[model samples]
Target: MWKIAVGFALFAGLALYILSKGGDIDMSGEKHGADATHSEAPATAVSAPAAAPAAPAASEAK
Candidate 1:
């Protein structure tokens, strides 16, 4: 029982240590020194297509 408690304490301590040093780790999944803001244009702006001209009326076609 004491061994199990000691093992758990050690594991918890290691986890806390890793978390404390998390700033040194790049967990952002982005390339190092890359600008996150300029990675890509806005989705709405990119996906939208240019507006087409209005169709001519039947009388106007004649």
Candidate 2:
């Protein structure tokens, strides 16, 4: 029990120290509605390779 308390204190202190060094830390937890951010990248249109010409029939070739 004592060990768990000590470990939690150390972790929390370290987390707070790091967060303090970094400005404007949002500790408000998860956001909702319009406050949420959309991390999805914009879609891109890729042009597919052109199809090869149709092969000639065996009878027509002969």
Clashes of each: 0, 0
Q: Per-residue lDDT of 1-62 in model 2, one digit per residue for the tens?
A: 99999999999999989999998667789999998875769899999999999999898996
Q: What is the lDDT of residue 27 in candidate 2?
A: 79
Among all candidates shown, the one with the greatest lDDT: 2
TM-score of predicted model 2?
Answer: 0.43
lDDT for 9 in candidate 2 is: 100
- The segments of candidate 2 whose C-alpha lies over 4 angstroms from its true place after superposition are 29-62
Error of 2 at 33 (Å): 7.7
TM-score of each: 0.38, 0.43
lDDT of 1: 0.78
